[model samples]
Target: MQKIAFQNELTISTVQQRNGANNTKKDVRKIQSWLTLFAMTNAGAATATGIDGDFGKATEQAVKNFQKAKGIPQNGIVDQATFDLLAAPMRAAFLSTITGTDLRGLVVSAARQHVLNRPFELVISQQPNSGPWVRAYMDGNEGREWLWCMGFVQTILDQAASVVGKDFKQLMPLTYSCDVVGTTGLQTGVLFRYNQIRLNPALMKPGDIFLLQKTPNDWVHAGLITHIGDDFIETIEGNTNDGGSNNGNAVLSRVRNFRKSKLDVFSIEGLV
Candidate 1:
């Protein structure tokens, strides 16, 4: 895909507008959409900020909040430095502050530690959250009724962060809906879903997340990519097992063949 730069010619006069000023110019409209994209990508600005090209308080406040996050003066102005930050990739921003001797191993190692739980049945009584060993995976995310694969993945991420006494939310946001993560990744330009590319298994690394895209916008299942082999991917997935059922009932390690399955792999190269 060709990289399209966000407008570099965004002048202060081009984006600035008083509370009662008219923002009908085409340039102003482009800047408003650009700002909205920037704010959403950076993760602090509210998504409700309408990209209507109206430089009202909402847009002003959104830009100001973004400026504050970037440690720029809160003058509600989009200067050159601030505009450059807007053009920066979200994946880089998310991982820019992450520090460790080996950042990639943290999550994969944390997930590998939980590879031995049992009885992955699809029935309600024997789900992934049923076992005392894996119950903690669902601690804050799910009640007893939860199936727990997504919870397991979420827990492992946070647990890895805890090993270094750092918060995991800085690396990845907490979410139950795999589709939302997929959607947000696409929207924020942080990740690209592997489809036609049939991404080579060697190209992937640990800490990446894989989504089972059952439909165009629907992601049915997800897991942590612990290791990759010549033809298969070794994954530690919740609510599943060696049987490969997406709705199974335990935290299990499974090897899935990339060439045979319709899985979409998303890289977290600089996102963890």
Candidate 2:
């Protein structure tokens, strides 16, 4: 597969992270971050002590445990091969090139690839919304204050749009707030409210953004619409888990019923 050129603040170099190796703080931190995210999804796997920029005994043991779980050599050393495995999920998602001329097709492909990669947020040192994935999508900002649902949506949109020389920031500002995106969509005549979309289902299309309406004027969360049916829409959302809460962790694929959920549509009809 051709690797798309995507660079983020957390991009790790090819340097190996192993005990007694002269590991830079940047490299060690990336290793710990990968280990942390890996443990969050896998059950009972050993997690790094914390992303403290250290490859201490605990981090080594965690690497060994991760190696064991992966059925690789339990050498407790992060060699080039081991680092490749550790960073596969993130590298695969960011590097994937979705080849197409259709903008909506590109958007759906980008969003689906992210869900397939499983960008799960990590709560390191009791801090919520702080992780490698969160930083990547949120433009190097991560913490409890940075709710990344809209950030994730924008990142995917930006990725898809960039391929065709279209900028999503023009449709809506590059913002992390759902209110900004929702209000911008409304002001620009691109937003279809729940009531309007319920009547005109054709207005909603794959790759259009879905805003979870809090009130008639307020949207609490945002996601990418991947499929639209008679009664439901399949969504790939960020900062949400299996329960579908706006504040939950991870990017998840969810089936949301239009009849039950107050989801407004932000159409990207003319953007392409």
Candidate 3:
């Protein structure tokens, strides 16, 4: 298998920022990115300054606006308190360590947190699929080439497994390709085709990775199953929006009908 590009380093620094001198700091870039994301997700929220890693007047005014909306002091500077709120979503993912025999539940919880946090992509520098969340999920690389559906699934699995002293990589190859993940599941005797699931829906469970199958040998998209209903399954998937395209934007919770879609399941029972 090919190596996973861009190491999965999802973290933010608690550095303070102001208008002058600290303009080109790396943390400034992160703050700008968060400000942009916050503005995008929250309606009527403060927008960011161009995300050019420069803490100019526009960035300061945006920060002040954010502070005012949050009911904090509108000091126009990113102090520890302000930075904490800016990085809350990323921090929320690692806030608690899940402990339980229900590995599926744990994974589902992780995926839910991500969806609630509203991870979405932002076009940067005329490039698509670029942003803090996209870069974080895709390891470090983010662009048009990096469709991050599988990347999000892998990250959620890893997060849940690591909390219980287990490693998901032991069960499946570290990959961003749905086809690669599906192929590995087949080799490991864990892949359940849509037809199999159609006959026995009980075989599927929460946290089981779902792959939208294009062919018997090709899987196009991936996501984490959160609920298995009578004829539909709920999913928390990334790099997708409300339209449910595989290569879209945002982490969203969607209900998909198994009877209508060719969705395959990769059981993580062995890993748990």
Candidate 4:
């Protein structure tokens, strides 16, 4: 495996700036191109097809080809598990190839260790899945409460603070909103609004939180700061199903480079 250098350690302000720059159509296309290149590289496919991050026919066809080769369903869609599998080996190789320091590995390892150290909480209502551990904190039951991914992020933040003997409250006012086409609000902790704190994935340090914006609803998903390599990120998140049944419970999993339409990658309070 080829080792790659991790990104620089980033602050909340810096992350916000990077995310803000992504608002333009050109930037979005650039990000999509990057993602397409990333996916093609791992899927053992050809990037010359010019998928270019559009998620159009070319990308879909590439996904189908990869799926057929992998013997998973030829769904033509890249779900979480498939995304993880495709990127994992390359990421591992990249990390190993990087020299000078093992900062990326250390960060990822720390996040995994943090999840293992905590007791699993039941995701009763919002997330009605059964798993070995609690992935995130859920608000209400299936029909009632909404599943707030940010809550889970907050939970992990709280746990990290406890380990360091710091007050989680001090980490407040973190950016917890998303920037979608028309929606905007500070009330929702999951979405990133304009002027929210953002971080650069390449500059993220250990204990920094990465916020992801879910499509359509524009909800946010949180992951603890871990490893940041040239091509991927390693994070430990709870309540992530990875295409499995919700009953699987929470556990530490490595997340490849995040590929979302509009996301905010920044720190809130804990890491400074």
Best by TM-score: 3
Q: Which stretches of candidate 4 lie over 4 Å from their true place?
A: 1-111, 114-148, 173-201, 215-217, 244-249, 259-263, 268-271
Show the lowest summed lDDT stretch of 10 residues, model 4. Answer: 1-10
Query: Model 2: per-residue lDDT, tens digit, 90-208?
Result: 77777778865699999999898889988988776678898778888887778888899998998888888888888887788878998998898889999998888888789899999
Superposed Cα deviation of residue 193, candidate 4 (Å): 10
- TM-score, candidate number 4: 0.39
> What is each predicted model's overall lDDT from 0 to 1?
0.58, 0.83, 0.82, 0.40
Q: Give the per-residue Cα lDDT of candidate 2 at 11.
A: 50
1 against 2, candidate with superior TM-score: 2
Which has the better TM-score: candidate 2, or candidate 3? 3
What is the Cα-based lDDT of residue 190 in candidate 4? 32
Q: When superposed on Cα atoms, how far off is each prediction in RMSD? A: 17.3, 3.1, 3.1, 18.8
lDDT of 2 at 35: 89
lDDT at position 248, candidate 2? 92
Candidate 1 off by > 4 Å: 1-101, 117-134, 140-145, 196-203
Clashes of each: 0, 0, 0, 29
TM match of model 2 to true structure: 0.88
Q: What's the true lDDT of residue 125 in model 1?
A: 28
Any runs in candidate 3 off by more than 4 Å, and if so which?
Answer: 1-19, 97-101
- Overall local distance difference test of candidate 4: 0.40
